[model samples]
Target: MPIRVDLLALEPNVPGRACLTVKKWQGGEEQLEFSIQRNQDGFYLQDQKAWSNNPFWFKVSRFALAASGEALEAQVGPEVVDPLLEGGANSQFQIELREQNLGHADKGVVRPGVGLLPSTAGGQTRSTYGGVDLSAPVVPEPEAEIPELPELFLPVAEPEPEPTPAPAEPVYTPPPAPVKKSKKGLIALLIVVLLLLAAGIGYWFYQRTPAPAPTVAAPAPAATNAEACTLDSMNSVPELTFVQTCIKAAPDSAKLLEIINQAKASKHCGVAQRLYANRAQAGDPLIANAYAREYDPKYLKASECFPTADNATAAYWYETILAQDPNNAEAKQRFEELQK
Candidate 1:
């Protein structure tokens, strides 16, 4: 049966989230309900339980909002619509069509090319002196002569000596100005002596101060996840929450593997999913392949964690593995088979 999706409600006022109801057209009275929350890149599925029973369930890679007529619609996926139907069933939804529309004046018109030409001719013209007459005689101007003047004799007169005036009294001599002695150098030397005394007192106090006594720090107890939850607690409390936290808190891969094996033996199916998922996303090919098997159609029938198979999810994880290790034959084969 084809799947049907209906929009129930948009988040109040802000429109940050959308609630949707989905169901198979002829499947039964059963229906799936979930919410999608907006993120920076797009939107992500918030309710996993909505499609938990769907064998063809897959991750929506992207979502975009669109307006159709008067109503708004969310276009989701470039994913396979139906896993059972291969080839042409694979498609993507685009919100709107972008067309290159040219205006009436812009259509089929070619602009003319402009060529530059010189404003004046390039050849040289005749010089200005070329028009003047050069054939005239070269005449030189004559020098003029001046007349000489006669010499005249003049007599010298002798003057009589007058009485010498008395010498003026010597001006009173003023006493030399008193010399003032500078005290700047003396003051500077005193300041230096005071600084030295201060330094000596500081050294004396430092010498009298005794060194701190040596002490030892007590050793810390070895840290372990046992404090969070234990296998024994599983039988008593059986709380999945604590078990998951303990699984994440397990120190190394070896410890994590130990916890996963024990959890499986105790029939704790979902505990290992998050544990393996964390490492898979961190780019571990082996862990990613193991995580993929949890949803793989070939293996899900036997899995306690997943009752129904999801080829899309398994294919997604397989593709993740291939991205990191392209030569991985298992992941490549599984991904191709899922596509078919």
Candidate 2:
């Protein structure tokens, strides 16, 4: 709190409205600032109102007395000093500053207690060294406290969170495609070929089986007499060939029925059956009914020809008769019985 500066001059002998210079040592030279003499004080300052706290006192511990050199030794520097902010940190180096020369540190004689010793020179100092008034009060100036500096703050930036990666999709995997059985088509074709071959062989066999030729019946001898009309002479009748069929149709219907009945009664049942099969297939009403009378259930007796009382050669001829003559009661009843 001690002031270590030279007391060069005091203007008007008053503390009010005095322009003073504050000096600081930097690089071994002085830097001066416009300041105020707050009171009859130890240090030059800028303004008295800038300090609100009661001033603290620090005396110059360096020896002080009558002028020791030709230069004015105004002991006006700070006493009991250590740098609180050295390299921006608290430091602990004991220091004691003795004096400071404000500006024009020449010729002005020193004063012991009252700051800025009185002088007059060149209108800057209105009094000389010999003009100082020793009668004034030597009240020492009060010291001031250096206010602690407000702390500076800097903002720090924050890092952004990294985006999380999406989960990987499952890979698709499929089973190998099944091998097609190439032989299956060939096998099916072989079976179809074999079936066609078998059918061809059966058809060939059926074609090779020869049918019996119609019996080449001998010609019928002319009726030599009524004695030729006997049953034994009937065997000599012409074969029922195409020419003989015309000769038979040459007869009257009554004669044709008589001839057919004789052929039937002569035990030529095969020929009769053939006649019935042909007349039934030909849809002849009279011949089909006549044939029906032989084995028709309506006319049946205990005869082997009508076994099961079935109409002759199946009910085919009787069906043919009734198809043409539905009013014929015999054909209708016999056809119905054959249905059973």
Which has the greatest TM-score? 1
TM-score of each: 0.34, 0.27
Candidate 1: tens digits of C-alpha lDDT, residues 1-340: 1122332223221111222233222222222112232111233222332222222222333223333322223322212111101111111111111111211111010000011011121121211111111122335686533222233232232353553564597565453333112245546666876777677767776776789858879775632556544566555543434443454454466666666556666776545554554456556787788768866888664545455565655776787698699999999999889767
| Per-residue accuracy of model 2 over 1-340 as CA lDDT, tens digit each | 1122323333354221122211222211222222222222223221222322333222322332334332222223211110111011011111123234433221111111122222221223222111222122245787744343334333333454564564597555453343133345556666876777677767776766789779898896644433332345457543233212322334334544565566556654433443443444345677667666665556654332233443223354565576577787876776666656
lDDT value, candidate 2, whole model:
0.37
TM-score of candidate 1 to 2 decimals = 0.34
Worst 10 residues of 1 by lDDT: 104-113
Best by lDDT: 1
Q: How many backbone clashes does candidate 2 have?
A: 16
